[model samples]
Target: SQKIEQNSEALNIQEGKTATLTCNYTNYSPAYLQWYRQDPGRGPVFLLLIRENEKEKRKERLKVTFDTTLKQSLFHITASQPADSATYLCALDMGSGYSTLTFGKGTMLLVSP
Candidate 1:
């Protein structure tokens, strides 16, 4: 079985600093990995996706890196702000008949001024 692990504790950072979140997994061979941002009382919004063959992917101030060899993924936000404060989640496809997504508990990030 595949398992995903993330920091259960909240990450606190000051505004204008880069925030790095980690996602670690074991016993899973995922074709791709996805990152999402979830606000309080709102569903998660897609952030970035990195394929197995791709080392990294970026969008605006967001960056995601997938290292299959290490079975880990790193999600980064540059020049983070208070608006960027949210719970970040990492998801993996189950790779079965249908599209089944397995998501982590998510890491909460707090950006203060």
Candidate 2:
């Protein structure tokens, strides 16, 4: 009964701007949350991971915030560029130290010059 969804459309934007993405879910009790960046026809690269007890996590220009009460997560990319254009994914931990990641369809980001 758990579900995760992300924007299916490509986000078109100019270079040097911040891009925001969303991940929404329901009926999942996750011990931790993870975000990944994927390029066309390739495996997703792990971005950030936040535990249930944590409020926020960051890596360089990327920031992620998790809200368990709302069952949602937010991903942010500051000073995004054309090279940053890629699909971002979110995963929820299913527990047992062996967690299963259910990825969203992903949202493509397009950064123009």
| Cα deviation of 111, candidate 1, in Å | 0.4
Clashes of each: 0, 0
Model 2: how far residue 88 lies from native, Å:
0.8
Highest TM-score model number: 1
Q: Of the candidates shown, which would achieve the greatest lDDT relative to the real structure?
A: 1
lDDT accuracy of residue 53 in candidate 2: 84
> What's the C-alpha lDDT at position 65 in model 2?
89
- Candidate 1 ranges beyond 4 A from true positions: none
C-alpha positional error of residue 96 in candidate 1 after TM-score superposition, expressed in Å = 3.8
TM-score of each: 0.94, 0.93
List the global CA lDDT of all models: 0.90, 0.86
Residue 87, candidate 1: how far off, in angstroms? 0.4
Per-residue C-alpha lDDT of model 1 across residues 1-113, encoded as one tens digit per residue = 78999888999999999999999999966887889899999999988878788999989999998898899999999999999999999999755646577999999999999
What RMSD, rounded to one decimal, does every model reach?
1.2, 1.1
Error of 2 at 38 (Å): 1.1
